[model samples]
Target: MVNGEFYRRYLNLPDPYGQQETSFTMLFEFREFEGKMYLKYQREEDTYNLFNKTTNAIILKQSFMKELFVNNVLPHQTHAPDATMNMNRSVEGQAKPYNEAFWKYYNAPVETARDSQILKALSEMESKP
Candidate 1:
């Protein structure tokens, strides 16, 4: 099991130091596509500083466990892309619109939790009604 502390360190979040302990919650949506698992997620948490209140971020990750370990295809390489420039140009044009929409919809506020002093201050703020 991956703990909150692992994420804090991985994301380079600041330690709570002598102040209150920091807390984090992650929500993920898992999907299986073409025999691979994709995890789309968002994380929300209090800052290390008391005054900053809450912070959040989104992430996407793909897992190829079956292909790598079960199928033993890690050492094999797939066929190369077509050498046709027209094919590539058309695909790139089609992809741009899709990429733009995807990012705009999924975009959210993101910040590092590595500032201990700032987090400590945010933690001490009054709760909302």
Candidate 2:
């Protein structure tokens, strides 16, 4: 939801390409006030300038996962308990902190669950075009 993390993660994942180096790189950027996220694909040098931006801006709370998966922008995963939780947390703004103040409220298991969820999601999505 924030900065199209799901989309970017799916694209950059090391697979399907058969160890082939990517011709382009991707990143996510959040625009909180707009309640939307941007998925940016930056290509190599001037040659890349010829391409147009395939920007996807969507509501922060919306699930762009299905659409992304269909468009090959996201990998499909049926067992992403962690990712599901993380996504829910992110939507609710109850996520474990990544900053210094995180430990004050979060426990190890919570973090582990979140990580596991993300990993499972990624693994399921490893199959790509």
Candidate 3:
């Protein structure tokens, strides 16, 4: 099981020295391509800080997990361009539009739990070393 403290440390909360806890929930979608992988995600904003725990920053969480999978878990030979760049280009392209719509439609609780499972699997892989 992943310790909650681990997540707190990983996020580097609002206060560096303060004991801040977070309660944000994140949903992730994963698909493996021929030689690369990508993550689809959504998360609550930093609303937890107002309380005691902090809500997860969706972009930060996504970037962190992406790096973890690439550097720690998935096997790859070299750095690849951000896959979303092609989709993000074009001042008036539909790719960006579609990307947002995809996440809007794809976000769900089932996928969220599945994403957590995948992270656990990756963590287990690290345990071997």
Candidate 4:
């Protein structure tokens, strides 16, 4: 679970929509690609909501979310070269309209099943020294 103070800071972040906030609980998926671990954010119902509420609120583009994940969520972790390349390719090749890509990535079938997996992963991660 995210710290309450962090959540408060996230809620109060500046954005194009002003004091916008996310009522939905965010989910994450941890996967290994090309021998490197990657974490992908997911949200139920509204895919675009994730981008708007998180990325936009931080006044950064969607690509910057990777930095947030690496630095904050998985500090000291290093991604494989191919994993980074794949992520960059996917981002660059997103659908014409942003929403389409949002839905494709965040609203995809795998995302719907990620909540439980994320919880388990979080528990395991926290149990480590």
The runs of at least 3 residues in candidate 3 whose Cα sits more than 4 Å from the true structure, single-residue gaps closed, are 1-22, 44-46, 49-129
Q: Give the distance in Å from residue 58's predicted Cα in candidate 3 to where it truly belongs.
A: 25
Backbone clash numbers for all candidates listed: 16, 2, 1, 0
Q: Candidate 3 lDDT, tens digit per residue, 22-43?
A: 4444465566766666653433
Worst 10 residues of 2 by lDDT: 43-52
The whole-model lDDT of each prediction reads 0.40, 0.36, 0.45, 0.45
Clash count (model 4, backbone only): 0
After superposition, candidate 1 runs with Cα above 4 Å error: 1-17, 47-129
Summarize candidate 1's per-residue lDDT along 14-88 as a digit string, tens digits. Answer: 542222324444455555655776543333334332222243322222221111112222224487645652333
Tens digit of lDDT per residue, candidate 2, span 1-129?
A: 246532222223232221211133333433332343434222221111121124332212211211111112333445545644443333326544578776676655555788999988898899654
How much is the lDDT of residue 13 in candidate 4?
33
RMSD of 1: 22.4
TM-score of 1: 0.23
Candidate 2 accuracy as TM-score: 0.15
In model 4, what are the clashing residue pairs, if there are any?
Answer: none
TM-score, candidate number 3: 0.21
Candidate 3 residue pairs that clash: 22-54
